[model samples]
Target chain A: MKRWLPSSLLSGMLFVLWLLLNQSLDPAHLLLGTVLAVVAPLLARTLMQPIGYPRLAKPIILIRLLGMALVEIVHSAITVSRLILFPKPDGMNSQFIKIPLDLRNPYGLALLSCLINSTPGTVWVEILPNRHELVLHVFDLHSEQWWVDTIKTRYEKPIIDIFHEEVHKENPP
Target chain B: MNEMETIPLWAAALLVSLLILGGSIILIGALGLMRLPDFYQRIHGPAITVTLGAGCVLIASMLYFTVLQSRLVLHELLITVFVLMTAPIVSMLIIRAAVYRDLRARKRDSGVESGGIYRFPEQE
Candidate 1:
């Protein structure tokens, strides 16, 4: 299975995306999509690093994480818009917060970075190589500890479950 | 096109409202870029527009197209997905460069005679 489908999730996503993009269930389209989905991953497999196995404990957990992340994204957009619209430079402390990452998987780290960046106010700045530490810049930095706790608990934990071994997770989400 | 008038009143209302909300959110974000004092703070504005505002606009488009054509017209979602994937990368690179430039400038300004360095300054 691993030999044939080096990246099952990627292949599946590519297949679905192909279908979605073409928007046709015709046999020809299906055949083409299947071929592309199979061949593309195979061709691109060498380029991708061999991560042991992308962990997805449960679909429900991932759905819940995405749902929570979506809500936070919306809420932060509103909060950031308000902060931007109402100028209060003195009160707003835009600063970078460094976090020591327990989640080390490449896929997991990418997802976490996307979540952090997409949510209006927070941007993942730099990650120290060799050391599992990340620097994130927050638009409204009221408390450093709060940002640390939120990123670790709310985002990183779920990601670790989604991509790392269950036993390895610091705080199981 | 006559297709505009043919769209149901409720669908039109929903479409218009979503587009308006998305546009206004983007506008607010642009305003943030203008109003923000520092470079770090200014980046937040575009972040709002890309994630939430683009999402809203894309959702509205999906609604409009699907209702008008009467099929699962969700290919437009590709834009949202693409934007979601790309926004962070662009920002990350820009910020990395900014930080790099800022650090070198700081080192230069302080008149520190440092050896050849080829690494990102650790954010502490």
Candidate 2:
């Protein structure tokens, strides 16, 4: 049973989603959804094969991250709106800044991209593998160093903690 | 004139305006899809519809239904949540596929990475 249903949380969420979508207490729908909830992942299990599960040791940190993200969203929204409504004299100073990263885990990199892209003023432009640099575009850049510091301190460290990887500490040029 | 009960004039006006605004924005987004010159620029156009247009319509739905039902009916929230979560994924997949196809075509056309460094090409 453990081998077959490796992710209890995922399976439970799938089952709940099935019920929410069906929206009926009818036995037929319940039985059908249950079958789907179990069988779908079972069928999917062969595709990539499961990797080792991370311990997920930091729930408090994750909550703090969520709070910080919500605050950032509001702040970034105001900044972007101002830029959109009133064109800056220099226009948008869009430049690709490459920040060297030590976090090599695939999942950590994915989370970093999601955080960067979800923020209004920034976009994750690219990641250069051979050089271990991730490129980002900022809508407003008073100082390149500030952006690099914010990314490393606010987003990257939390991800590193969650994913548990050694990342090299480097100052942006 | 008899004081017949009707939706408060202001409420009716607000609902109508919101519905129109939502519909028009969605239409404009669709139009942008055709009018924009390139794939990347065109992609940004639909974000307006998905974010603001859908938001307007959902708010209108919530407002209209709450008034009618005398209590909040929030089934519309599922639609909003699903759209919000899924739209980015859909957009990313489409962009990635388009980039991959362009790179493949470029390679066959010139057999060089001179165009740019593609992170995950079709071959990968």
Candidate 3:
């Protein structure tokens, strides 16, 4: 099973996406979707990094994180709308800040970046190469420490828990 | 169209409200791009459009079709998924390019000197 389905999660998503795109439950579509799902991942496997598959140690945490992110997105959308409609006389305080990251799992970092960027007021600019710090640009700067704490506690902590990178670090293969 | 009659009143109302909400949100996002003073802040404008705005319109489309056809029409989900997956990457690249350009010119807001991610040519 491992040999054929290198990433079962990805394969399943691809299969479902194929069927949905076709908008059909026909047997022919099912057969074609299955074949494409199996083949596409295999072909793309060479491009993937050697990092071990991300194990969802706690799936519930991931779901909760997504839910929280959705709420944040809506909340920030309103905040941003207000900011745009009613401009500050002195101009908005937009600035770049760096947050140190403890979650070393590439997948976790990717998800964090996506989540941050998806929110209206924040963007992930870059990661410091020498240091495992994320450079983020904030549209409005209220307090530097607050943003750092929020990113660390609210976002990074849950991702770290879900990925369980500490276990990987402890027992390296 | 005859198909328009197939949708229930509640569904049609919901669809219209969602579309209006989404369009207003997108309009605000576009206004941000023009109103924001700097590039970094400007990029954030479209983030709203990509996330909640697009999401609203897509959900409305899905509901409209599902109600019209009397079936589960979810291909719009593919658009949502693809947009969510790719929007960040595009913004990330654009921001990086802008940073590199600003850093080369020794601009104040590049944050390269403070960020310590990439060394400025003067430092090198």
Best by lDDT: 3
Which of the two, 2 or 3, has more lDDT? 3
Model 1: per-residue lDDT, tens digit, B10-98? Answer: 99999989999999998998888887766777888888888888888999989998998888898987787899899989998888787
Compute the DockQ of candidate 3: 0.56
Sort by DockQ, best first: 3, 1, 2
Query: Which is the better candidate, 1 or 2, if ranked by TM-score?
Result: 1
* Model 1: residues with Cα > 4 Å off, grouped in runs: A89-91, A166-173, B108-124
Q: Please list the residue runs of candidate 2 whose C-alpha ends up more than 4 Å from where it truly belongs after superposition.
A: A50-55, A165-173, B1-124
| Residue B82 of model 3, lDDT score | 96
Clashes of each: 0, 0, 0
Q: What i-RMS does every model get?
A: 4.8, 5.3, 2.7
Q: In the order shown, what is each candidate's alpha-carbon RMSD?
A: 5.0, 7.8, 3.5
Quote the positional error of residue B80 for candidate 1 in Å: 1.2
| Per-residue C-alpha lDDT of model 2 across residues A1-173, encoded as one tens digit per residue | 86777556557667767766766568888888778777777777666354432334565776788679757854664455444445567444544466778777665776676556555556565566456777654555688888888888998888878756322222123
The candidate that wins on DockQ is 3
Question: Taking the tens digit of each residue's C-alpha lDDT, what string does model 2 give over B62-118?
Answer: 777766656656667778767766665666566556655765765653312232344
Candidate 3 per-residue lDDT, tens place, A1-173, comes to: 87888888788898999899889999999999999889988888887746645567888999999999999999999999899989889888887778888887778899999999888899898887766788888888999999999999999999989889546654566
Q: Please report how far candidate 2 places residue B94 from its true position, in Å.
A: 7.8
**Deviation from native of the Cα of residue B25 in model 1, angstroms:** 0.9
